[model samples]
Target: MRVLLVDDEHELVCALAERLGFRGVRADYAVSAEQALELARTTAYDIAVLDVKMPGMGGLELHQRLRELQPDLPAVFLTGHGSELDFAAGAARGEAYLVKPVGIEVLLETFARIAGPWDGQGGRQP
Candidate 1:
């Protein structure tokens, strides 16, 4: 499945995207909310993995905008802070939330749980 990964930490997002590619998932990344929005407008991403605390627009707001663009798109939030408040807020919004430094396996598993199984055949399984 295709993924949109957004984070202010450019290096971290790039590394994660690379790792995801190695695992047979295609990922497009953006370092800012605006960039993510632009990518979302042009790309049909199946899921979005967003960093919670970005510089201009936080993940929550970005998710709102993305949902406007693609109402059924699934999103997962990642935060280095691991704040209970943030976790609760994300949960309240019915989003999949993960702490930063998350294992790729864990992230992929979460994606499968939320977005359905990735069949390893270039698309999600029904």
Candidate 2:
């Protein structure tokens, strides 16, 4: 499925995008919340993968803004920190939260579980 990956760590986001491409998943990335928002406005992504702690807007806030842009879009939060507090906060939002250094397989599985199977056309199938 088409994914919008947003993180302040440019290298990490780009690497993740490249890896996703290798798995046959189309992914676009943004290094900032503003950039993510702009891309969200312009492109139709099946889901978004956002860093919980970002420079300007955090993932939760970014998710809210993105939902405003595409109400049906799903989100997954990624963070380096794995604290109970952070986990609870993310869980409270009712979206998948994955720790950093996640395996590619786990990421792909999570995407499938959340957004369903990719339709091979940059979208998800029902």
How far residue 78's Cα lies from its native spot in candidate 2, in Å, is 0.3
Residue 54 in candidate 2, Cα distance off native in Å: 0.7
Q: For candidate 2, lDDT tens digit of each residue in 1-126?
A: 889999999999999999898777899999999999999989999889989999879998999999999998888999999999999988777369999898999999999898788765555675
lDDT of 1 by residue, 14-93 (tens): 99998898877889999999999999998898889998899989998999999999898888989888788989987766
> For model 2, what is the C-alpha lDDT against the true structure?
0.89
Estimate every model's Cα lDDT from 0 to 1: 0.88, 0.89
Off by over 4 Å in 2: 119-126
- Given candidate 1, what's the lDDT at residue 115? 77
Top TM-score prediction, candidate number: 1
Q: Where's the lowest-lDDT run of ten residues in candidate 2?
A: 117-126
Going through the candidates in the order shown, the clash numbers are 0, 0
Q: List the residue pairs that clash in candidate 2.
A: none
Q: Tell me the RMSD of model 1 versus the true structure.
A: 1.3
